[model samples]
Target: CSSCKESLEDQCSSINNEDNSTINNLKEKLSLISNFQEINLEKSLTLAAEVGTALLQENDELRQQLHLTKFEKSFSELELEDQLEESSKKIEKLINEAN
Candidate 1:
């Protein structure tokens, strides 16, 4: 009866040790998961900031391009008007001379 009691005590002790080891492993895994989640969140925020900056830059560039295009169109219209006036004057002079 004493031997049976000793064996049972040893088995219970072994089971307790195994349970402690399993708990320790689970705690370590939880800590690692928390660290990984934090790192991922930081990386996502950084990437979002970078993307926003790039989009703003592109918007500014497009605005400048639109301004330049408008100026070019206005200049062309003025040039065409001047050419038409010169042609009209030349035709009038020719008609007067023929008369």
Candidate 2:
């Protein structure tokens, strides 16, 4: 009975050692995962900042293009109005000469 008890105690000690080792290994893996997650988060933030800057620049460029288009449209409309007025005046002169 004494030998049986000794055998069970040795087995329990071995199992405890294995459990401690497994626990330590799991902790190390968890630490590595946490480090990787931190690095990924930093990279994601950097990328997001870069994308935001690019979008702002694009928005400014689009706004400038829209302003230029509006100016051109206004200039073209004024030119067309002037040409129409000149043509009407010429028609009036022709009608007066014919009368």
Write down the RMSD of all candidates, one decimal each.
34.1, 33.3
Question: Runs in model 2 with CA error above 4 Å?
Answer: 1-39
Error of 1 at 34 (Å): 22
Residue-level lDDT tens digits of model 2 in 44-89? 6765565566556556655655665576567668879999999999
Query: Which regions in candidate 1 have their CA more than 4 angstroms from the true location?
Result: 1-39
Q: Could you tell me which 10 consecutive residues in candidate 1 have the lowest summed lDDT?
A: 1-10
Which residue pairs overlap in candidate 2's backbone?
A: none
Each candidate's lDDT (Cα)?
0.64, 0.64
What's the TM-score of each model vs. the native? 0.58, 0.60
